[model samples]
Each structure stands twice: as structure tokens, then as C-alpha cells.
Target: MSTDRKPDIALHFAPRTRSFVALWLLEELGVPYTLESFDLRGGRPTTPEFRALNPLGKVPLVVDHGRPISETGAIALYLGDLYGAPEAVPAADDPDRPAYLRWMFFVGNVMEPSFCQKMFGWEVAPSTAGWGSYARMFEVLTSAVDGDGWLLGERFTLADVILGNYVRFGLQFGMLDADPRLERYAARVTARPSFARAMAIEERESARFPPAAA
Candidate 1:
């Protein structure tokens, strides 16, 4: 067995949140790390202890080398770049870098908010909204994949790591209907040994802190 201790990647995870993305990235990197699960029900993340890590009181926060990194895209990109896993993340010099960054941020900034808006019946004007509308966002997402196994052609980069979580969540919550392409892609990605292990961890965490309150 490897005697080296896992890198100090402190993940403050909560059930049914974007923490899954960080967990999946850790698994994909095949690195050992510590997981500090926080319950959102009691406002645990907002407590002084957790607030010191992230004032926003959000899950999916990571403290690497004592540097707190919140936001899923930031954490994924940081890990992928630091670990030199170009296959999991494109290099900055790659021609696809622009596209990769664009989509990665889009998932967090655009798609996620749109999903929440649609799910919660929030009021908004399509003209003023960056996401335009839920249908529009979904259409764009579908077109981006277009039956591809991954977001960037044959390469399964960090883009997949970002979008894969949403695809699964959307399908599970009935926010997204069955698209053969998305179905195939999600299946293919989740079937990876790394993803399987991540899902196991997430499942256990979910059991420990159910998402009913969140």
C-alpha cells in the first residue's frame, strides 16, 4: 500500500449540493483527501467555525494548503491544473481553452441559476436575464452535447466534470427529460471507476445528512 498520506484537500461537503462536483473531481484525480461533511439544516456552514473557511456558508468549499477555494469551477480547474491532468483538463495553450472556460463557467453562472429559477418559479424578464429562459438554456445545452460522449469532442476534460453533475441532477429531479445523447453520456461518465467511487461516497454522505431540509 502507498505509505504517503493523502494531500490536505479539505472539502466541506453537504448533502444534495454542488459538493458532488468536488468529490467527483477528487475521485477522478485518484488522490486521497479529507472530507469534512457539514449539515446545512442547522446552518452549520454559517457557524463561526465554518464561516472562517467560507463566509458565504456554502458547501462544496475546499481548503487546499490552507487556501480556501469556493465555487465548483474554481476548485475543479485548480485541481486539474495543479495535478497536471491535461486529459481531465485542457491546457491554457490548447485551442479549446476558450471554449472550455466558457462552458465551465456557463454551467455555474448560467445553467444552475436557470434551473433554480425554473424549479422555484422565480420571476424574471427574458430580455434582462443572462440565461434568457429555461427552455433556451436547455436547448443550448442539448445542442452542445448533440449526442457526443463528452463536451469537447472525444476528450473527457474538466468540462464533463462540471456538466456531468448537473446532467444527473436534472434527470433525477425531472427538470430534464430523457435525451438519448445525455443519457448515454451520463451513463458513460458515471460508469468510470472514479465516478463510481465518488458516487459511493456521496451516497454515504447523503444518508448521513439527508437533503430533505436543503
Candidate 2:
């Protein structure tokens, strides 16, 4: 959504964190913006002003024309709607919207929490837990994400940005059980120029804030 006036957008991001999702999204948006990159240890996110924008005190927050957008799914949807057209996001009434929204929410709602459940070795009844059990979560993933390649087939949407990045990270860090199709999918996601650009900026910021000597 281009305008005669360019939007004053800035991302309050921290390197080597979930902020990469927002960074990649911004790159995909192809809009001019500033990266308010900083290290988390600086106590910036915990500040009152920051918390006012996002009560969670998190990175990956986008200040778009003075309106703050937090949460990965919300960020993806908001930015996608603002800048995405003809591609990136499916139109509201489009047939793909339902599934697009499903997978988009699936990331933060099911996938990430399931990983946490795995990490903590927590056991909860399938019906009790919000993630509906880790194994069950994976089952749903295994079924939806197969041979078709893109979750929505030929269309790559914001859902791919959210879930695809998790799958890519899982593949990279050995966090996910081996699934050949997901492996191929991660390869496809990483191959995107937007992903590459985001990684490059991450590298530069990472070095710029290299860990302090012990």
C-alpha cells in the first residue's frame, strides 16, 4: 500500500531473536523503514515506554505510523495488509484466506508452545493443554504439510513466513523430528531473497553487538 507520503515505520528489534521474523517481513514488504536494532541486555524492552506499546516487553515490535503492533502473527498480518498486494497475503475474501489464517495462527498458538512443552518435558492431557499435546500437534503438521510444498500450494503467504521460519529454525537446530517434505520446504524458504537479506542484517547486528568478554 504505497502512498504519496512514505510511512514512518521502525522496528524495535533485537538481533538473534524472534525479531528476525519481523525483519524478514519488513524485507518482504519492500518498504523503507528503520531498524531500531539493539541488544536485549540493554534493558530497552523492559522500559515503561516500551511496555506501554507491548505489555509483554518483547522485541519484534513494529511502530507503524505511531501505532505499535506486537506478536508475530499480528505483525505479519498487519504489515502484510499494509504493504502486501497481489501477493504476500491472501485477500480477506479469497479462498486461501481461511487456510492462510489457520497456519499463521498455528505457529504462535500451537507450534511454538508445543516446542516449549517438549523442551520442558511437560506432560498434559491432550484435551487439557492449549497445544493439544505435542505429539498431536506434530500429527497435524505432518498431515497438512506434505507433498504440496507450500502450505497453500503455489501461493506463498505470511503463514509461510511464520511457520516456515520455525520449520527452518527447527531444521537448522535439530529441534524437529525428521520429515523429508519439511526439509525441502525449509530449503525453499531459506532460498527466498528476503530471508537472505534478513540473515545478512542479523549477522551484521550480531557482530555489532558481539558478546562481552567474560
Candidate 3:
């Protein structure tokens, strides 16, 4: 059932990006892999070799068995399907499957654009915008994680890994300011052992590539 038949699993990654989600996922998978870590600002991903893998030259490019996957949501789903246990990825019969897929896409489709709109002061009607406005996105997210420990209740699946980083970044960048429930939820997700492992790697890579000057 695994896509990558070969043993080679390398993450084409850079720190301080969505690569954090991919890092968290690899740790959760508990699989042996290599990190092709680099600095985005240093033009590592833009090289001809790396650009062949992902034309956009983006980080979080996961190469499994020499096959490349670029998007963060897609990477989460890929690793979850291939290596994740039942707890990480519910079976087809599981009722949480639908919600799991929904929230995963919600992070990229809804949260990404909505956050951009809010940050850049973009003006668009709720009915016209696909995300219905950043305010609505927050409302739906807050409602989902308000009382529940995870998105699918007790089960902490790949959806958490997909959405948790965005929620954490939102708080850190003041995008989701003054939201107590979301703050607590982000804390809980980052407190996981897998997250700790990812953070350790992140720290090492970040030190390797200090951020570019503004």
C-alpha cells in the first residue's frame, strides 16, 4: 500500500516555513529518512537540481522513493496514508475520515488565503471570496477546537499536524490575537513528543541558516 517502494525518503526542506509541518509529520511517522535541509533565502531550492523536483522552488518538497510532492497538505496526506497507523490516519470506514480530509484542505485553501487577505489588507466580499472572509475562517476554526482536544475529538490525526502549525504561526505573528481557545489548542499540539523532535531539528537547521536581512 505504500507508494515509495525504495528505502530512500528525503525531505527537501528549509527552516521557518511550512517545512515545520513536514518535519512534524516525519517524526510522527517514526520512519527513517534524510533531511536535505537548506536555506530558502540562500537560493538552495532554486538550483537546477532542486527546481527539477519542484518548479516553484518551494520548501517542504518530500521525495519518497525518488518521487516528489510539494504542497504541505498533500505531503501530510501522503505520509499519513503511507506510514501512519490507524491513530494517525483513520481507516476508510472511520467516520472521522471526512472531517480529517476537510480540515487538512481547510488549512491550505481557507486559512492560507484568508490569512493573506487579512495581513495584506485585501478587500473582497465574503460571498465572492472562496474563504468567505478571514473572520469567518477564524469563527469556524475556533468553534471546532473550542471544547475538543483535537479536531476529530479524542483522536489526534494528521489533520492536527496540517492545521496545528498554522494556528501556532497565527499566534506567533499576531494573526490570531486574543483567542484563548486557539492559543491553548496550539500549545497542546506543540507539546507532543513528535512536535518536540521536529522543533529540535528546526532549531538545528535554523541555526545553520540564519534569516536573511530585511
Candidate 4:
């Protein structure tokens, strides 16, 4: 449901949150937008004004078309289909469309929660749990990467934006082991100019709100 007129896009963002994922996707879309960067450490999100946009008071909320869009996966899909350049979003009839959507959901649904489960040593049966087990999740992700590289074979779509960022974070935090193929895929996709742009923005914002003293 894209509007005919391009609405002003404002990213209500903060560093050290899921906000970076949206920033990377927006840069990859190559669209002109403004960053409403704020410091979560400063207690801005708890204000009534911010809570009006998201009751949960979260960052990385995108206000486009005069409406706020929360959740990283939703924001990526909306922006990808609406303004993504070089056809980063697949056509409705494309065979890879189903798989493309699946990967987008996988990042938030399976990847994040499973990583938390592994990190915390949560006890949950693979058969009953929605994400199964961390091992299975990792295996599934590994199998998704094909010989041609990228999730969708030859095309690099928004799926890469979502999945690539998560893998990059996993590698950085040592949550994931040294899987050569995953490492290569993360390097390849994130090496894009768009990712560089996102990183630059992230660096500037982080400096403004430096990590707390140890």
C-alpha cells in the first residue's frame, strides 16, 4: 500500500539497538530521508511524545507517509517495495519471492530469539518451540546460502539487508562461530557502499552518545 506521493521519511533512531538494521536498509534503498537520531541513554524514548508513536517506546521507528512504522522487518519490506533502487525487491511474480519473504521474517523471528536462547541457555524443546533450536536455525541459514551466494541465488535483495546485518552482528559478538561460508556472505553483502554509508552514520551517532563508562 504505497502512496502515489513520496512522503517525508523520518527515522527516529538510536545507536546500540535494532535501529541500525533499519538505517542500513534505508541506505540500501538509496532514498533521501532524514535521521531523527536520539540517545536512548538519555531517556528520550520514555517520554509521552515518543510513546505516542510506539506504545512500547522503542527506537528505529520510521515515520513515512505521515504514519509511523515499527518493527525492523516491516520497515524493511515497506521501504524495499516502495523505493528500493536497482529492484532490490523482487517482482510479485518472481519465483524467489516466497523465499525472499521467508528470509526477511527469519531474521527477527528465528535468528534473534534463537541467539538469545543460546546465549542464555534457555531450556526449550526444538519440537515445540517456534524457532526449534539454535543449532537447527544455524543449519537452516547455512543451507539457504547457495553456490551462487546470497539468499536469492543471483539477486541481492532486501533480504540481504536484514539477514546480512544480523550475521554481521553475530560474527562481531562471537555469538556465532567461524563459519567460513557465513563469514564470506556477510563480508560480501556488507561491503556494499550502502552498508558503508550506514556504518558512517552509526559511527557519528555513537560518538554523540558514547558507551557508558565501565
Compare the candidates by TM-score and give the number of the best one.
4
- The local lDDT score (0 to 100) that residue 206 gets in candidate 1 is 86
What digit string (tens of lDDT, one per residue) describes model 1 on residues 97-169? 8888888888888888888887888888988888788878888888878764688887888778778788888
What lDDT score belongs to each candidate, Candidate 1 first?
A: 0.80, 0.84, 0.87, 0.85
Expressed as tens digits, the lDDT of each residue in 1-214 for candidate 2 is: 3235556799998888999988998887788889999999999988999999999999889998999999999988877876775566888888888898899999989988888887788878878888897788888887777775688988877788789899988767665787887887788877889999999999999999887789
lDDT of 3 by residue, 96-211 (tens): 88899999999989999988998899999999999999999999999998975899998888899779989999889977755989988999998889999999999999999988
Q: Which order, best to worst by TM-score?
A: 4, 3, 2, 1
User: Which is the leading candidate under lDDT?
Assistant: 3
Say which prediction, candidate 1 or candidate 2, comes out ahead on TM-score: 2
Candidate 2 Cα deviation (angstroms), residue 188: 0.6
After superposing candidate 3 on the true structure, give the runs of residues whose Cα lies further than 4 Å from its correct spot. Answer: 1-7
Least accurate 10 contiguous residues by lDDT in model 4 = 1-10
Which tens-of-lDDT digit does each residue in 1-214 have in candidate 4? 2335574799999988889999998888767789999889788889998888888889789998679989889888888777775357876677777888899999989998898997899999999988998999989987786455789887888999899999999988877666877888888988999999999999999999888989
Which residue runs of candidate 2 sit more than 4 Å off their true CA positions?
1-6, 212-214
lDDT of 2: 0.84
Residue pairs in collision within model 4: none
Ten contiguous residues with the weakest lDDT in model 1: 1-10
What is the alpha-carbon lDDT of model 1 when measured against the actual structure?
0.80
Compare candidates 2 and 3 on TM-score and give the better one.
Answer: 3
